[model samples]
Target chain A: MAPRIDTPGAAAQAVDQIQQLRTRISRLQESTPPSMPLETHPALAGLVQLRAGAAYSVDSATLALALLAGPSRSGGWCAAVGVADFGAEAAAALGVDLGRTVLVPDPGDQWLEVTAALVDVAAVVLVRTTGRVAPQAAEKLAARLRKRGAALVAWGEWPRCEVRLTTREPSWRGVGQGDGHLSSRRLVVEAHRGSAPPRRGALWLPGEDQTYRPERAVPVAAPVEGVA
Target chain B: MVVWCPDWPVVAALADEGLPSHLPAAVFHANLVQSGNAAARSFGVRRGMRRRDAQSRCPELKVYRATPERDSRTFETVLAAVEEQHPGVAPLRPGLAALRSPRRVRGGETAAAALLAERLVELGVWDPRLGVADELFTAEQAARQASSQDCRVIAPGESVPFLRELPVESIDDAADGGDAVSLLRRLGLRTLGELADLPAAAVRDRFGPRVAWVHRVVGGAGAVPLSTRTPPPELARHVDFEPPLDNAETITFSARQTADRVVAGLAAQQLVCTEVRIDAYVEGSDDVVSSRHWLHPRWFTAADLVDRLHWQLQGGFKAGEVRAPVSRVLFTPVTVVPDAVHADGLWGGTDERVQRGIARVQGMLGHEAVVQPVLQGGRAPRERQALVPWGEKPTGLRPAAHPWPGSIPPPAPSRVLATPWPAEVVGTGGRPVSVDARGAVLGEPARFRPEPGDWMPVAAWAGPWPVEELWWEPGGRRVARFQVVGVDGRAWLMTWESPGTWWTEAAYD
Candidate 1:
């Protein structure tokens, strides 16, 4: 549980908002609640962890995929895998406000700085990096984000954090679209913490009206950069 | 306490843009500055005279437009960079932003200024001039005197002495010279050094107590550091059309190009310009300036911009009107300002859509057709409102979220009523006395009558909301106004606000 304090100023307000979000996350299931705003809970929050050093041969990818397609009897928020492709189909994700997304430049000297700035701003931060971040810096950033009432949906490999999660590639059946457009692609994705896994259910292309009816599936890679 | 924040990015970008086109891009100072001594002044060079003119006059005036913005931004960056190394630094403005959290010692003021200048050179900011003093004004003066990165601290006990070495006029030598300094200069205290040397008795005797207080500036008194002013909300960008693109296609194309430049510039400033000045040149005559002002109370879209420039195309010399085909089209930013998001946060801080809609309505009906109400400081309705200039930086106009009291609401609009129809009325006693629409017994209402047919109220109303407009002069509207209640429960804000002759000024919408 997040600690409560009686401090004044912007930091205190940020802490209170985040704590409120953490407490509100209890009611959510496997699917996004219809007509509900993000004010209600941390349905989309992701707990990203990292190892001490940089290496690519870790099971993090499989672990992430398993989490995205994990089995949960309860329907809930889609396990979105964020990527940096502007032209990718995930640009039109259901229940996601695309305008809130931010595109960061590659991981050079300014990457960590930019990521830290983006912590409170973006819905998801797709960092294109091949190296691990220092432990203290990551912890500081996570604390800042949580306090700001925002979540860290981190892409790119990092060692570890304190949040537990569940992972699996649950089975999928019923693969078809009502209209002529071919839809539905099978893929495994991950989630952190003891949260239930995402089923292999299909997410449809968000139409002009912006609804996610799960009507069809299209072939698209996970939208996150430097990920599986 | 004036502060100058020469937008370094803007200055650098403009200077860079001017370079490819072979134009000299320097923000040169006016007289008394460049020529610190008598010799250059003998050559007839003034501070702000055009460079070529100065060059012709002095032949070696060392005429250089200042790179103040470079010095300024560099100064700020260096301060930040130094702050990163040493914990706390207090900042003063105009190339001398500092922090006194943990000051550098052993003559820390000078040493720190020098250290910051060194950091600036490392960052590739030019000339690294540094000045440190007890106050912002004197610190800036000290910095200007610095030829290189070495620190020049105005000694704590020696501030008056340090400032006295400079001329008294330099006290008001700020970017936008305040009038107080000018009045002081007119009183003939030529140099600050001289002024400080004068005795207080003599100083106050001839100059008076009010002028005496201003002398403190010459004495280098400390003041709260002034902040850099917020940027203006207007757009201006000049385009140099090469190959003399006089065709309509080229001009319209250039408009879009320059519009993009302005939009990009606004984004960098974190603001927008609701007005733009479009200039077109016939290319050969030399410095032919033709321009018009475009304004909106809100942001305009690319289409709105295209339309205005389209009207402007009629004025542009199309292949037929010039000795040389029109080679260049330019847009100069007159004013650009930050969009004040509603205090309520209804739009999530981006109201571009609403602004664009206003632009369209203004464009179609008329730019003057729609207006947001602003309370001018006057009692009369016309005097109550002066037109609002576009790209006006949001300042003290609307003091708070509350509506302006004793001021009429806007959208009463811009049409003059046809005539003030008069009326005469008989009271319940059926006597031969006259009553105005307001039911006050008057001589007569000039052109109106009570109708047995009209189903309006006959409630007794008060006499004149009297107003006198230019009544002392030969001709003016002296009128009175009052409120009348109808039998149907409708109340009208009739004008007795003006004295005798009456016109309904406004209604509660």
Candidate 2:
């Protein structure tokens, strides 16, 4: 009394047809939040804040390490692309959970492609652009990064970045003559934005003993109670 | 009931090479013959024979290196074929498998076995054999006896008599871990009947528990229980194309559904796959075009599976290369773990979005591009941490708990210099500070100069802790470490290797 099973392969084909439809539907229904916000760094307080769908620039590796460490330690995924000279030890020292960090030491000619791919996965992507990027390519990558809700940490220059950190007058500490070690350095960091006077502050790039500590006012010795 | 494929390693190796089964083929492992086909065996090529000797016996024998993967993959296909008829077919090994005795057919056990042999033949297997008995041991013996027929059945009580005529060597290998058969032969017990006739307690005391097990098996007194396991449905999924499309996009697109189904199946069973074997087959052909085993950090998702396939198609797979892509794709989950143990912790582990993002990036870049940091025990800051690919369980590395003598004490350095920089330490008279062989400081270190900076006097300095490593070796090294604090409140861990040579190892924040 049952309808004749048409071609023996019909059942299999129908199963395949149903599966394709399901995949398409599931993909369409998938929607991710526009951005995954990261907590702002204390040192870069007023100047830099982490938000996906935008680009941020940093001048020093030490600041970049500090900026990345904050989010990464809180369980965000970070990636470094085409930054061949990145010091893994320095990143680790600054509290960047290297466990959550991905490094593409060299992306060669596929820097944009690599960055684009990284944007889809990593919450924060640090790209060291080697040369001038085509305006079209940059626009496309920026749009993709925005759509994916990933922040791009540009090592080199980037146009219209949400925040730009530039280090000036860097002074090394701890070392004297050629005998001691370079323990830390103090840098005056200037944050620049569109049509805004650059905000400047002084802090140890990596404070005394390889830490990112805000510059503290050294208590004046108070004339040492007549010791002189 | 047991169904066994004899010399399966040779069969599988030959099948992989597209060689005829009738050829005089013998597989070798480590220069010794492992399994030889009937054609090679007839020419005196035996198991464990040295290659040169086997070659002497059969000059025209085609030799092959052992490949366990091929054997396993082929046997898995055999198991799949058998599972179609008998659901709970438990694989004993690559060449041997057992199943629960089926309900009697119109022609009884022989007819049932004939049907099995017929099915194996249809799958291109020649001279397949089957045996049925109450237990696995006697059933295996029945299968061995059925070598000349399609099937053999040992009636319930006939197992003892059937086993009696056989040599004691027959039951020897299974029970005793060693060569119990040879020992029994040395003891003048040629037939299994003689071995079985011995008092059970005497056998147990003389030959240990294993021999006692053998006596029970042969005497038909003990039937070891069979662990009947059926392959889970989620273990495999396959899709076929009518016209055999060659386009990678189309093939992968079609495979997405199958992958999703496979993953969903595991999820339904509260399991997740850690490893999976993907197979691609050309239209109308049993020969696999490409096959690969992908390892995952966590359970595989549909997208992860699809990404791996696409990567492979785009030249990621080099060995057993997929020269032509047409027809069908099969995904087989090889390793799986329970889902209960894998659930993310509350507010601790990565969220689903994070997992997705990382996987996407890894897929785009390459598998090894993303790495996670793991703390490991070591003497120096540089050696204290290791980087492992994200998602993989960290293994095969030094444990962090081991107490490393001479390692820096608490208040671990905030950052470690990947490459140590050279520096110099001088005393008050501008004398380059040095440590003597007896661990005594040569000078009171005063001025510190790491580079071309102005000389800064050391405010406070710690001991010259000398350490001698690998002293028994010719390339031994001795270094004296010192901690110095500058007026700038910067601390540096400096090491003096020789009289005038100093290296700044790390800075303590």
- The digit string of per-residue lDDT tens for model 1 on B50-129 reads 66776677664443445555555545655556555554445454434544412536655555555555666666544555
Q: What is the per-candidate TM-score for chain B? A: 0.39, 0.65
How close to the true structure is residue B400 of candidate 2, measured as C-alpha lDDT? 72
lDDT of each: 0.43, 0.75
- After superposition, which runs of candidate 1 have C-alpha atoms over 4 Å from their true positions? A1-228, B1-237, B240-250, B265-276, B282-289, B292-327, B334-347, B356-358, B373-457, B470-477, B486-490, B496-500, B507-509
lDDT per residue as tens, model 2, A134-195: 77887787788767777888876887777788877766655454344455667788888767
lDDT (Cα, tens digit) per residue for candidate 2, span B24-140: 989999999988999999999988799999999989999999888888899988898888887888888888899988856668777778888888988877867889988888888
Candidate 1 lDDT for residue A30:
29
Candidate 1 chain B minimal-lDDT segment of 10 residues: B409-418
Docking class of 2: incorrect
Worst 10 residues of 1 chain A by lDDT: A173-182
Q: What share of the true interface contacts does each candidate keep?
A: 0.00, 0.19
